[model samples]
Target: MKMNICMVGALLLLGVAASGCANNRDLIAKSVIPARNDVFTEGGNGAQAGRAVVDFTLLVKSNLYYLMGTYGKHTAPPYRAHLNIDGQTTILEADPILEDNNSVGLKAPESGTGWKYQFSKRLTLAPGKHRLSIALPIDDVIVEREIEIRPGINTVAVTPVYKRKMLRPYKGENFSAGVKTVEIAVN
Candidate 1:
């Protein structure tokens, strides 16, 4: 009789444990359903869905000697940068130019000025490759590149630096003819 009672008790305990697991499974499913609703869609069709973000920074290079010899001071003129994402163009106005007066960091050369500006935007891109075009209207320069945006954070750096060779004097003049060039870097 004791053995039969123990078997009945074990079966009851097993039934309780199985029911608990079923409740836990339902709880897990309920928790995930709301999170799945927050997914971002890149296109109208239900093709691509996920969260995508992009961080972009702009760095402008300046030569201290060139500025001192030519203009006697470092200056950064305001310019606008435009980004084309998936055939959509967005304009980003340049912040007021700032000259770095502090000591140079180890990564930078000591003789030059690093005029920097930055902007960021979160993108809802499809889960595949896309075309991105960056345009600096001040210099009339545009760079077209393809990038694959995954379901996480992506970083990009756009460096616009004037080439020293482009500033040569024209027709034996002491001052150089006004010329500007942009160098782009992507990361």
Candidate 2:
């Protein structure tokens, strides 16, 4: 009777709600390298008491569109880094790491030689909680995270969110991108 119809309708509504939640599960589409358990392997020894040092490793994936045209593509792009501690924000300078033999992107290695490139910076921070934000313009994404510093050398590796589409057509410019929480660990 009427009770049976009401129960069926309620179950249908619940099913729809669960499917919507599934779509929102993946906020940022990217694979984390080194994994979470292995991030502390490269941080070296811990820092001294009352003082914490942070080492940053920037990883930028090569854009595949560069191979389509004859124009030279730049592998290193300038990035803006902001570190906020105790309500104070500090802007850090970014420098590019030169690859071996001046190689650009990841390609076939010549004989036994290999090359890699990235930007790195070290910051001395007081023992406590701090927030770090990195703005990467290549894909118009900003990564933000909160980290705890406790008498040790902390290493953070940053990279853009992975996307399946390699090439995106140029569109009209009046738009804003979404913000997602990027995980950064303090070793």
In candidate 2, what are the lDDT values of residues 1-187, reduced to their tens digit?
A: 8999999999999999877544422321221111223122222345656667778765443321222433223345433444433334444444433233335332222111122235566666666765555554334454556777667666766643343222332321111121222345556
By lDDT, who's the top model here? 1
Candidate 2's error at 165, in angstroms?
Answer: 1.1
Query: What does candidate 1 score in Cα RMSD to the true structure?
Result: 26.1
RMSD of each: 26.1, 13.6
TM-score list, all predictions: 0.49, 0.45
Q: Rate the local accuracy (lDDT) of all candidates.
A: 0.48, 0.44
Tens-digit lDDT string for candidate 1 (102-169): 46442232123344445544445545576666765444456667777665565666655442333442
lDDT assessment of candidate 2: 0.44
Model 1, global lDDT: 0.48
